[model samples]
Target: MTAPNLSANLLVELFVEELPPKALKKLGDAFATTLANSLKNAGLAPSTAAVTAYASPRRLAAHVTDVAAVAADKPVVQKLMPVAVGLDATGNATPALLKKLAALGADAAAVASLRRENDGKAEVLFYDSLAKGATLAEGLQKAIEAALAALPIPKVMTYQLADGWSSVNFVRPAHALLALHGNEVVPVSVLGLNSGRQTHGHRFEAAVDPVIIANADSYPETLLRNGSVIASFAERKAEIARQLAAAAAQAGADLKPIEDDALLDEVTALVERPNVLIGQFEEEFLAVPQECLILTMKANQKYFPLLDTAGTLTNKFLVVSNIRPEDASAVIGGNERVVRPRLADAKFFFDQDRKKSLESRLPGLAKVVYHNKLGTQGERVQRVAAIARAIADELGGGELTKQAEQAALLAKADLLTDMVGEFPELQGIMGRYYAQHDGLPAEVADAIEDHYKPRFAGDSLPRSRVGVVVALADKLETLAGMFGIGQIPTGDKDPFALRRHALGVIRMLAENDLALPLDRLLNGVFAQFTGVDGFQANPAALSAFIYERLAGNLREQGYSAQEVDAVVSQQPQRLGDIPKRLAAVRAFSALPEAAALAAANKRVGNILKKIEGTVEARVDPALFVEAAETALHAALVEVVPQADAAFDTGDYTQSLTALAALRAPVDAFFDGVMVNADDPALRANRQGLLAKLHAAMNKVADISRLQ
Candidate 1:
């Protein structure tokens, strides 16, 4: 029998064919975490045990420190039936009790050892037993099975084992499985493969056919020394980044690889051994838009495009090779040759696309259906143009109106261009280039591209006034159209990216501090869809949706939820003022009187709500039977003008601060006056006094939310 206290580092590896590059990192992390957590849960490892995860193109491995060979025994107490059911009138065991004991590997002879205890309602018979611990072999087998079952495989592959009779499903066909506790094989199986101490390394650069891991602690070094592979995914990615930077510096001063974490992860997942090499295409291909060339190289060939100090794409790029050769000239030359044709293709698309102006492509949009209920792209463009014109007029019409309308019309035209057809991501980008070629106004050309600004969170808003107007119109049309057709996002199912569109609109308005009212904007955009069938304009629903998105966004920016709710709950029409209002609320919350005032404000609101009808702010001075009421009324007269002046000038912080003086009188009034008095006239007068206080206090925000 294995010693109960025996402990050692454990190693597990699943060797297989290449995994999906995008999903490799997630799979490795999940496998290691799930396996370690299972052992910890089963009491085979301590909660503080250290675990390390490693992934290469062909293997996923884990090393866990200080795992036990056999779990410790634990005591368990199980409740049998009530004492009345377990015993007879003669104080003898019943047959039902005997049956339950038998299932627990006990018999009637053990009845004397049973204990009686109250289980909340009645005295019940309890049985105590020691559960035998699980051996490492048993625990590891379950852990391996659990780990494989929990992998986030993008897609599963089914294949037959070598024996041809058995089959299994995994991310890829399993070639071998390696499991070890210290230096001993743990005897586990997964994906039709038995655990062993051997794993293959790099395809061609490895010094051995099957590298042998002597112990769990030596797995990484052993694989690296004999197999010519870097075992850790993070370490390999870091090495690639270092090499890319060095190569870029050597190529030229101020040159660096484009920054894309996703691309780096994918490249790391595609190789076991990384060797960064410099490759170049003809400088003539640089005439094509750098975006097109850079995207093709990165997306298709997994190459990193180098950029100059000015952020201009250079003729050179970096290639991460899977093998390290003494002479990398052939590899570099082969990459250059392969990329030449791709650049040529980009050039071809650019040349062919420039033959027609963006205005000429406008007719092509009619053939493309945007959404079944929302009409074609051509119609959508018209709606966006109309919204842009109305918004520009609101902001002061002139050249701005014409530029915004022109930009909106030409924005979606490039979606029909050859370059954009090949690369859908180049939709707005290509529009700007083609507009420039067609000799349109620089403002209009820039707006065509900038209208798609803030496509994702943390992205910049439109750069100019025309751009902001057009972007607002574009995003608003999408939101109004989708919400009007009842395609609102529920849960995570935002197929149309309506959430992103809403966020884009919010960011533009708030970040740019545009003077547009949200209600008016939504109504105008919804009005654009009046004649379309199956379109019902619900500006209220759209406004609520935008405000909800704004609330979440504000909270994420580090404001307390109470502060955000206080400002957002009012559904302030001017979204640009949200930041100032939130600042004011936060500042007001720090005051000594803030808490008392908030509670008093809440009390006042509750009292007013209980009344049958609206309580006017007008109060009769003659009805002030209590000094507290008179003092409160006198304080409001002193504070209202100062607060209103600050508020009119957009000094929200000062506006909220001015109300702090009224907290004392307000508290005293609530303490001394009975709002619902026996005299109807007096009670109504008191409520009106409270109403005036509530209105003045809540102008900046609903301070009651701070309560």
Candidate 2:
């Protein structure tokens, strides 16, 4: 009878000083994954073992299920020397063979059972053996060491151990290590701490001094009931979220928490026993921009600001405290007291910033260095204004031109504002507020704020035409200036975020479907850099960079690689037309004749490329000598005009569909007529006929790529 496997659930915890809040979650995840993976690699844990990670402000823990007491023995095959090298004329084992066998812990007697196989050219001998399984104690120690070594610690600190003579580098000072297997303590050591069942919990609110974890399955329950801590990171985060929603609901039905995942994550890492408390500030502080107030609350204090149904910030906010008390008035009052000074400082910055208009800050930008080689922010503003003006003209010269230029000039003026200086993310937002306070045109103010829209993936684009023009110009100027100075992005090293700027430009043009040609816009930007020293003009390289980004963007939008390659390979000047071109390619690919036509188009392109000179796409009917050629020429005469008309009218699908009539003629011509004819006139005429066919087939996209 076969024996059943002996297995158990294992738990490990590392008690330490408070970990860095930003890195706590990642550290917890890395700790659990590395430990589990190492155990699995060592065969001490099943491949399907369940791993649960626990993290609190003062601890990191992991619980793995179905770990074996010892791994099962595995069979191994060892390859030896070839038969010719291992044996002599008498077919007896040589000294080399004896030595190889000895190294494998086998003697000459084992050679009789050796297996031989022809490995390509010659026969080689191999030995088979069973490797002994590793014990759980040894495997667990190795897994713990490896997991500690693999932690993604942002910074390491060296601290002396209790021994006072030795020091270790770690993310934080280590206090205790707890390792348990099933219901028994597993003797293991890490970071100068021995394994134990005791661990400390909440600094002030624990039900017991030392939480006794009875078993691997009881770790979280013990910590919560006795230690007054929620040990699981995910569970604690969800609990905080639930409490926040409930608190917001209690405040008012129309009120809701300002949703920010990053803020929630940061707050989650800051507490063990989360207690939501309500706090309020003076209503006069709302006179400051809500963005300023909210940034102060969220960034400085880690508070969740409440908002009304109209999305307006209220005077009250919720504070997530680590301790729960019968009467929470003191906690709420303490938080309110701590936040009053922060709000007052924000108000002071706002009042000081509003003392001067954005126009007044224009000259100050000349002193701000944007880049050491690219001159000052003032110069950049001028360049952006020039490009915006040109784009405005191309988009339809009118009020847009004036608004775009004005917005571009004032866009960087916010860099000199007190609020923006205090919070760099508030640059554009503060500029809009200041512009409106200065009584500038509403379009100009909105454009200034909207120019930096679509700042990230899935973000909204500019809502106004003036904003679009300025946004395009702003991104273009960055691309042109950076490329001019030879600061091109290489591999993953884009210090200037040039790839993001290129994507922003592409999204603006393609998503907005503006009439501006990409090449023309790039040239306009390059023109603004005239007379700048050390600036090289390489429009083609910059154009290639933008097109590469466009190709990736198209593929991410779910277009097939072939479709994107076919369209982008042509370097279409109007990016706005790409979606239509892709649609046309998709529609054409679905047609019954698309496959044959694409293959034939590829064949035609290869033939035309081999010719010594340009093949004019002008066919002469009189020069066609074969019936196949004459038929193809007649078909072209009838279909080319229809396709051209459809193409001119922007009916790309219809244009490609019209060329489907040439498939039969194309196949017949290739089968019966030789493209490289014996006579020069016949060859030239055939080449012209093929060139005409090629041009018609590829008006929307390079259909040959479909092959």
Candidate 3:
């Protein structure tokens, strides 16, 4: 393939044993980045760069293009080894330099040739610099190796060097190594495999002697036509989607794309010539819960299911296979065998779970650990129930709270059963089955099942208030319990998924329109936490940590990052009060002087922040020399009461609006009077007046936090 109109080029391929779908996808993207960044750091770069990544079960390839042939070369600077002891400031080498040269196995003649500077200090500097327009191949190779070295392959192995060197360790046995600069394979070696122009195609199709990959364009098509596998992930995905629809049409059904991209990526590896064939399951299996059927099809069978007009699932499945089966009977039978076991497992679990009441499962949860330090799952249920009841009563759900109390007590009970334990993902799901079996109200059973959603972004939300309450309570306990032990998600490591939990809380409140203040709720969780070493929780520390979660949560909700910053700037963030505060600030954010107001507040803050000597706030009204100061004082007198009322009533917009009334008077005072005037008494009064204005502005938000 000719060099595809690119300035520079990049190609990277990992030939590994079958890789997990999730890991392969992650590594594919990661490999692209490593290659691009590697080029940048080596004084090498691309005019335009694109990383095309693809992965099958056994191999991953990242191709970067439009890169410079050679990275801009860097100069290697060499400085004479620290003036070789005492040289008496002469131009001759000292005894120390003689000893070092002898020790380094360097010739004395070479050291003598390294002369001193013209200035005559016995030290000289030399630089080995490479100018521009050099080939970037060597630099690119080094970058690739660096990136590959640090890769996070959770499972790795070492392959013995067939070339008689040490074993090469990697995620899988890297069958072959390939790196290309446009059409040329950059010579490098890894895992005892030489880098070259040849790339092997599909094992089933082109398993003979290696095929030559002449260039970039030729590589993919050649692989597709003869190699029989499309190594470009985008191509593989499109083909899968196309075939799925075609097979659905042939089977007289429609396939809806499941909301499981990870599953899609995983299935991609299990196939080369992705051919979707629609198959059928017994219609009676529909009696299983929709979730059980869908999960079984998607998770176990790697099949996509079809639905009827009323939205009930039809007895159809979409089977994506690696190789097309000519007769299709064998493929159909194999898929049925795979799906039948899951369906049977779901059916058996459904039947077995119903033999006992949700309440019966409660006692078993005591044996399950919520945390080694935080009692049992049974204990957690009690805590969640208490919080849920309080929240329900707050929301005027007095009747519902009592029912939710019953549900919360048994919400996690199903966690102890064999089915739920085996399928930990079906926590609330199993609870619903067990609840319904005991003839509890449908609302309660539904709530038990629906409590943990929308489990992910764009996922479904809880329909029942009972579910919402339990969901909130459960998340609250997690945040609290984790925080109590000083375990919060930081960086990319959230061993407990605390960030997800926080986001879930934010979604529950916003999507459900619960509009509950998170302060009181987060505070409640903190209250239940006993710190490490069995120490009672420090209410102060817990409050600070939850504030971080709240700020992060707000930032993700399309709230301006600065708005979250401003709201969090308040020392004691009132969780129950933040939503209203944020709303008020958002409403005022676009007003003619909104940014000015925040700027003014921040300016006032810069003054108040540095109170070297205590300045009393008793502004001497009698000595108000500037007319603007008196005008500002008059506005505060008029606005304080109304602003306070608005703040208390959660009418943040109104509060900010009322505060803005002081802007004109504030501008007038600063325009005429020096805050630090020569007259000590007048300066004191001016500072006090400014402090008063700042105090009034803070009711809505620290305003200084706004942009």
Report the number of the highest-lDDT candidate.
1
TM-score winner between candidates 2 and 3: 2
Query: What lDDT tens digits, residue by residue, belong to model 2 across residues 1-707?
Result: 11225788999999999999999999999999999999999998989999999988899999999988788998989999899998888988989999999998999998888889999989998888989888777888999999999999999999999998999999999999998888777778888999999999899999998888888889998899999999999999999999999999998889998999999999999999999988889999999999999999999999999999999999989999999999999999999999999999999999999999898889999999998888999999999999999999988989989889999999999999888999999989999999999998988998898898778888888889999898888888888999999999999999989888889989888888888877877877898999999998788999999999999988998999999988899888888888888899999999999999999989999998888878899878898789999999999999989999998888888989998899899999999999887898888889999999999888888999987
By lDDT rank, best first, the candidates go 1, 2, 3
Across residues 1-707, which tens digit of lDDT does each residue of candidate 1 receive? 23446899999999999999999999999999999999999999999999999999999989999999999988989889999999999989999999999999999888998999998999999999899889898999999899999999999888999998988888899898999899888888877788999999889989998999998999999999999999999999999999999999999989999999999999999999999999998899999999999999999999999999999999999999998999999999999999998899899999999999999989989999998888899999999999999999999999999999999999999998888889998888989999999999999999999999888888888889999999999999998998999999999899989889999998888887889889988888899998999889999999999999999999998999999989999888888999999999999999999999999889888888888889899899998999999999999999999999999999999999999999889878878888889998998888889899999988989999998
Quote model 2's TM-score. Answer: 0.97
lDDT of each: 0.92, 0.91, 0.72
lDDT of model 1 at position 12 = 97
The residue-level lDDT of candidate 3 at 99 comes to: 67
Instruction: Answer with 1 or 3, whichever has the higher lDDT.
Output: 1
Candidate 3 local lDDT, 1-707, one digit each (tens): 43423354567676767776767667777776776777766546653566677677767777776666655545543444654452436756577666656654554565545544533655553323345544566766676687677676888877776666678778877778777777777777766777777667766656444766666546677667767777877678778988776776677644454546677777876766787876888888888877778877887778888765566677887888776647888988888877887888888887777777778767777887878878788878888888788778767876788877777787888887767766788788878877877888887888788777768766777788888887888777777777666786678898988777776776677666674766666666656543335634444654565567668767777888878877777843345566777887788887877877777888888887786776555677898877888898999889988998987787878988887787788777768877888887787888888787887898667887776
